[model samples]
Target: MSAAEFDWNLATVWETIAEELPDAPAQIQGERTFTWADFERRANGVARTLLDGRASRDDRVTQYLRNSPEYLEVSHAAFKIGIPAINSNYRYRDEELRYLWEDADVTAVVFHGSFTATVGALRDRVPRVRQWIHVDDGTQPCPEWAIPYEQAAAASAERVRAPWGRGGDDLFLLYTGGTTGMPKGVMWRAADMLRQVNDVSTVHYALEDGAEGIRRDLRGPGQAHISGSPYMHGTGYFGATMAMHGGGCVVSLTAPGFDAAELLDSIDRYRVASLAISGEVFAKRIVDALAAEPGRWDSSTIRNVLTSGGMLGEQSKRALLEHWPAAAILDGFSSSEGFGMGWSLATKDSIPETGRFAPGPNVWVLDEHEQPVEPGSGVIGKLVVRNRLPMGYYKDPDKTARTFREINGVRTSVPGDHGIIHPDGTIQLMGRDSLCITSGGEKIFTEEVEGVILDHEAVTDVLVVGVPDPQWGQSVAAVVSVEPGAAPTAAELIGHVKARLAGYKAPKHVVFVESVPRSPNGKADYPAARALAEAQRQPVA
Candidate 1:
């Protein structure tokens, strides 16, 4: 099938899936399972309600629901109306939410009733928000200004098709995790985003027979996915969207929090074939649970175990391979602002020492002067990307231009990550450029340091940060979580890392801690870590 022949609009894709497999499960959350037909009907109903309330085609609707049937319905509803929906991370505080609400000019909001007080605090801050619809999961009282989600959606006419232009319409505005000052909104066009799935199936999956291959292998009867990440992040959102587009089911684990037992049970019960998770934490937990109760659950249905949003350590990778010998453990690297840059495909041979990620079209590592570096040069540079990238940060042109540059007179979006292009053409991600530390005029990436320290026997988790120094501009510091009851000295841990890396790259000071703070998406909370290091330092007399 040619690119022109494929319907790039998300609504059109949903419609096609509905036509092909109307009775197949589109989403399974707790006791509620929504089929393709049901998904379409509910979305259409929600669209009718939004339109009747005078929402414009390009208006923004914000969704604050958890991982449930309503989140999927509202996402589709906004798509049907040509309105860009913003999926709010449930962990956002009032200050963060206010910035996002105002930044996106959100016209309406659909949130869980439990967060009514949180939303109420920001009512006056977001002047443009016209409607507040609440979904109650029996946790808290509904706010006074909020209307029931079901009632509002049911009050409108049924499934009246709206004729909104499809191709170039901005479908969603996802907020970036603000490791910096404030989170920025990424504007995603429908056609450009959906085209990414084509690459996933054809290039990454390497479907031999093109469309036929997709039909037989990816979307065949009983094909399903289980997502452990929240829908607000790119990993979960893309996983669910891809499953629906492929005419497959999305099995939602009903666990309130991340529980290895619940995840394993959900996969076995639903017979999920494809599973996507944030990182090695969930995989390690699953491995530990399985070890405790050997062969208690039937996991033969799982084929692909996709890991993204964070790194999968060697220990967890080995554990996964040991437990699920038949499953292919795939590691993907990308961010909410960027498309999928690389992925490690399933292989029959032994796992290589280096993680393999297939590079996306027009993605490469560039030196300080923005020139592409040769593989195996032992030089690390910023990772730059082109082709179907986001427009820029919403309402922040200064930052948008600084990070997303026009290299060689061609517009490109670089998410400020540093990496080295291996000799074999695979990209080795070296963490974000903003997190890079400069000490004694030498640039050292924090992820490289953290990776080396994590290999130590006493270390459970580690975060490397740059601290202020009198001589050097910044000094390397390590914040670590050691094995319980094993209080390894700071000097001992530093020596371990120094043995693997240059003395300058090694941490000058090490602080043992219970845990390293992480973002919702599993990336290191560098800002918090830096603050902790700064506070712990003794003042110069």
Candidate 2:
């Protein structure tokens, strides 16, 4: 089918899946399992509930639940009713939650009972929220103002018809970190989101022929999958959606926090075929767990290990290879924005520096002038996108126009990234352009230094930043996690980077820490890293 001819709507996608695989397992959370038919019924009930409550088309409903079957039901139900569902990052404190709730104009919030205190603290701060619903797993008490999730589901009507809207209707409002100001919401149309499913089905999964071929070859009955990232992020959303698209079972582990052992246990119990993990931290944790109990879990069912959002540094990559050599480790670069860009299918010979893949259609690496850079130039440029780009940031047109621009008649979206386009058209991603620093008249990218440090045997994970220096405008600083019981000095890390990279790019100082903070999507928390560096530079009284 032609791209234009394809119907890019969530309802259409869900209908197709329901027709093709009515009895297939759509979602699995702990011991709970939902077939495709069951999912549709639950989603319909949710839509009826929201509609009866006077929810209008395109109204925003924020979800603050952990990984569970309820989150998926609410998401699908919101889509069926033509209301956009915003996934709130669980890490947000009261202040951050209040800001997002106020900014998104969230009319309703669905949160787990455990977060009652946090939500209660911000009740007066968020004036837009009209309804408060709590998902109680039987332990926590339902608050006075909140409705129980099960009761709401049972009371709401079922099999409601779709709300009137076209494919371009708003589907979601995902908030991304801002370069200069507060986090900005990127609005996604239903058609644009359907394009994401198309990209996954057509480009990534190579499922152009349709569901028959996927069912015959790629997936079987009760195919198990797991996403080790928070549902609020893009990767988790993509992974869950793709699993449903293929008629596979999505296994969600509702751990109090990230625990590699618990994740592996779920995989072993479910015989999960696919696993999506964000960064090297989770990967390394899995590797360590496997090492500690080599015979405890049966990981033979795992076939694909999808990693993204941040670097799986050379160390973690090597560890994964050693543990799960047969699994295909696929890495891709994408954003909350509609740009689904590059991919790298890990092979036996793939390395951190070599075998990086090229971006797909609608993506390009451009120079400072926003023109496509010449191949083999080795000059770093901003990464740009050309297809189905966001119209503008929510409520901020001027800044949106600045980032999403038209260069030489073709529109492009540059999400503040530094990269190099190789002669073969492959792009090597450097850190964000906003994080680049100039020290002693020399410009250096933090990612380059972090990559070098990560290659060291003793380092588990690392982050690079710029700190205040007396002479140099800014000095390179490194924060790293070392192997348990191993300590390396700042001079050693500097020497390691100096040997592989230019002398000026070497870190001037290094600090060892238990772990580096990361965004919900596994991107390096550079802001936190820079704050740590700044705090360290304080003058002694």
Which candidate leads the pack in lDDT? Answer: 2
TM-score of 2: 0.92
Relative to the true structure, candidate 1 reaches a TM of 0.91
Q: After superposition, how far is residue 341 of candidate 2 from its true place, in Å?
A: 2.8
Give the true-structure RMSD of model 1: 3.5
Candidate 1 has which clashing residue pairs, if any? none
Question: Top TM-score: which candidate number?
Answer: 2
- Cα lDDT tens digits for candidate 2, 91-121: 8888888888888878889899989989888
Total colliding residue pairs, candidate 1: 0
User: Which residue pairs in candidate 2 collide?
Assistant: none
Q: Per-residue lDDT for 1-541 in model 1, tens only?
A: 4554443356765665575677888888778888888888878777776775465675788888777778878888877767788978788899889888888888889998778889988898898888888888788767778878877667544555566644445566778774666777887776567677656631232223334444344443347787787787777777776666677788776655677788888888888888878774566567778998998888888888778876666666766777777888778877766787777765445564333466777687889888889888978878777867887777888978886788988778788788777789887666677888899999888877787777676666777899988899999988887656888887787788779778898887776667777775565678888887777743222
Q: Which stretches of candidate 1 lie over 4 Å from their true place?
A: 1-8, 153-158, 163-165, 201-222, 346-349, 353-356, 485-488, 536-541
